[model samples]
Target: MTRKPTSSDHIVDEKFEPWERNGRMPLPVVWVAVALAIWGTGTLLTTSGGAPETAVEAAVQQDRPVDAPDSGAALFAANCATCHQPNGSGVRLAVPPLRGSEFPAQGPELVANVLLRGIDGPIRVDGHDYDGHMPSFSAAFGDAEIAELASYVAATFGDRDDGVDTATVADLRARAVGQGTWSGGEALAAAYPGLPPQPAFSSASVTPVSADVSALIFEGRDDVWACASCHGDLGQGVENTPRLSGLSADYIAKQLRDFQTGTRANEHMSFVAKGLTEADIAGLGAYYAGLSVPSTAAPILGGDLKRGETLALVGDWDLGVPACFSCHGPSGFGVAPNFPALSAQQAPYTASQLAAWAGGHRANSPLSLMDQISKGLSTDDRRAVADYLASLPAVPAGSTGAVAKEGDGHDL
Candidate 1:
């Protein structure tokens, strides 16, 4: 104890922790420890990832803008609100309701093109018409203005998420420049080809043997096709066949009598109506006018109601299109005599008429604006617009023209 401590003695006396004592960890142990830590960290990260933030949350965190541009509201107010209205309910007969219309939501390009070009002559809007001049904005407004207006209409009135931009307007403007003015019939034909041919009315198949008033006139006689042959089996009418449902009995009776008396002339209808007796005409008129009109609502594909309203009232003048309400009447009930009511028509039936006009199947009248419009429409455009029309409810009778009730005089 008295002698000086040696180096060995000092080393034995020093306290050493477990880690300090070992120069390095065992290879396997080290690897296992690192792997465990990594796994734990990865699990934590995955759990956090599973609870992703919502778009609003992300925007809040990133400080992104959410409000629409000021110009969007301004453009809409100035150009679109007149027909669409501030509340977007749309006018009853003169214009279609924009809040639920189908054309604005079709796509930015389609909406833009319609705005630039305009439409004309008895176009249906929300089952109504705004048959006035729809002036062209293409020459007056720049791409930005059109884009802003379209964007506002699509988002606010159409209830769509897709936004319009300048690019879309520019593209439509270019297309309008290349194509001259378009009539409704021309537009429709250009859009949809391969439309089915009009079937000849078969009186033989339609004639009824029973003398029941409703059966004889509405049901037709054997060897004489019933009115329903070319019209819908339900009187809704098919492709190229006009809808007979919901028309006034007086109007219908008058038309039938006219056909028989040679007062009215339609190649197909003349032959059919000419053979009908007064009793037959009366029965048919009563049967059709008495029947309730079925609902024609279907899921619209690629349309926006807001845009439809605009096209209906304002029209795209640049494209030589005319306003729908001019001939169709303020409400889509039509002006009577020649114009057909457009509201509440079946989707299939509507599509067929557009296709017929485009294909030159139904245009026989010298004043047929439909033929001109059908030729101008692209297939896509026809579908978009017709779908919009099909979605609308029929206008009440008294808005623009006199309406005949079920028992009204025999003039549908």
Candidate 2:
């Protein structure tokens, strides 16, 4: 008596409504279908276990800081690859190629400007038109991060061996504080068409006390020995001593300051610098910088000329050494107030300095760059490089040295 089998129980009323009377999908079911579609599209950021992740949660999962881009490559991959492409080939007619572009070769400033200020509207690169918008990176990156990004770009695609430094980028940042995105390539080119500004001290501090300075160099003061006692009357230096002529004022001032503060330790130099006032230091710097370096210094050592030449021109990277010219400047003329003229320096003096650096005795160089490099050099290698450096003539023969005057200290 199980409610006797009835045919009516198996059939539903055709006229009666189930849940809704309307012949449409239910709203709840529609919402669920939309959610499933969204999941299928793969827009969800997820963990390895396939759990959904929010922005902060994703950072936590990856163990990366919320704001940090991780690395230069990561920064470029995230921010630049869309239009620039992963390799920096860029989109034809829409974007520009970074590789072989004359812009990167021009200098760091142009490249830095574009990155910080973005480019809007049209710009031509390598004779091709790039008409897309490049978003500003100023807000998203710090100077150091930007420098790294620029360096990565330069190294990877632009064929620039010397990478951009943070100080340069920071300088750029200071200049670009209030500037907006670039209007056009032509305008930008017009504005900064010349050389980027040089950072060293370009002017002398006090009036050129040429005769007084010359007297100071030739005659000993109460506290100091006569410079000429060790150096030549012209400050050209005796055997094994360093010549003070043709060096940058900034370089000379910094050296004297370093000696005075014990940042650069030399018994003689420490005493000499300690006896001089800041004005005296600046006056001496101007006097020396005004004089031209002699074309040649008498050799105080001998080495394999061929090996020394190779080291000066192109360094042996296997030995963890860079060429002398790379940092010293092209043709060893000098790179302003930092690396002085290696050419025409006394071989013995150069060798002694290198030895000092190797033995951890001197440590005043920026970033200790020289100290690290010297430590890696062999004794023979040092001697060879020093000899080659002393062989070069700073200028043509028949040129005379500086002539002390009343006030004006012009190049002689």
Candidate 3:
């Protein structure tokens, strides 16, 4: 059988031989390519108009609920509730109460104006004066959202049944283009003269105190003397004592703690601080932080008023002193969580503290910045700047003070 090889054996099927002998693609590969082509073509045809949604788009769609867009209460709780409070009875002296306020009740237009543009300066609400800034909502909220917020505020606080309309909000927003914040009450009054007459200033109208403040400060707790005895009923301190109203809660608490630890030396305050518990310090801080009073501080020291103004507004670069406003905020309203407001602070207290810093008697200033700053100032210079600060408004009209910079030493 092996005697001779036949030619028939050598001559194989032409197509099969070529494919098998040569390194060509396998049948499975060809089939896979064809299947993939078919699937890609089908997918293209099915979604010819657009590509599939991105992960971010899908996530956004899933995250937002339908009702969230229209819910005024939800928006308020997210945005306005922090300062104005949940019940709309805003913090006294710090924020104006909306519950019984006539401003919102007048019309949606007035509220829209405020919401869109914001308002600033010393405003007399009820009988109390509030020197603070209301920020603009134009950038934060859309027309529809603004309308919803206005409606809610009107209905809930202003007692208005009809809420504001989106169209009206849009129109007002359009008109507010290129305009700044409303200056003050006078400016708002000029715009719409039909506002309710402000009641006469009443000393009796005091900020509502918490139970803790009442037990400890208003009424003496155990051996501790009543805080109101030295600091006035409204936390507006008498002669030689520092004004406590509108000071940052953290600053107040820190000072008390410092006093207790003998880090800050004051005969009366040291004794008082020793008796205070941690809870007492916190309560006292919060209570005073909520209280705001009009500044009646005047320059008793015979410092040059113009020179004082110059020093406060822009510091003496020749002497290497920084502007008071640079750290304390433009109008000395104080930066939150740290800096204490100096605009309405008593002149004596400010001067004494400055002197203390210069003499190394007080060592609790942030980074010892006050220590270095005070060292540059002479006794008369200290008095001059202190007087100027006392004379300035806590939150000046149209000034950029409330918008604080991140992580800076604030003025006390």
| Top TM-score hit | 3
Worst 10 residues of 3 by lDDT: 394-403
| Best-to-worst TM-score order | 3, 2, 1
Tell me the lDDT of model 2 at 206.
Answer: 22
Candidates in order, TM-scores: namely: 0.43, 0.46, 0.52
Question: Candidate 3 lDDT, tens digit per residue, 172-251?
Answer: 99899998777666677777787754323333324566786687787877778889888887777754688887777777
- Any runs in candidate 1 off by more than 4 Å, and if so which? 1-53, 56-213, 228-234, 237-242, 248-274, 278-294, 297-307, 397-400, 403-412
Question: What's the C-alpha lDDT at position 33 in model 3?
Answer: 100
Go through the candidates in order and give the C-alpha RMSD of each one to the true structure: 22.9, 24.6, 20.6
162: Cα error in model 2, Å: 42
Q: Against the true structure, whose lDDT is highest?
A: 3
TM-score of 2: 0.46
- Pitting candidate 1 against candidate 2, the one with the higher lDDT is 2
Which residue ranges in model 3 land beyond 4 Å of their true spot?
1-205, 395-402, 408-411
Give lDDT tens digits, candidate 1, residues 341-411. 55555555566666777787664433667777667666665665555555444433333234212211111
Ranking by lDDT: 3, 2, 1
lDDT of 2 at 182: 70
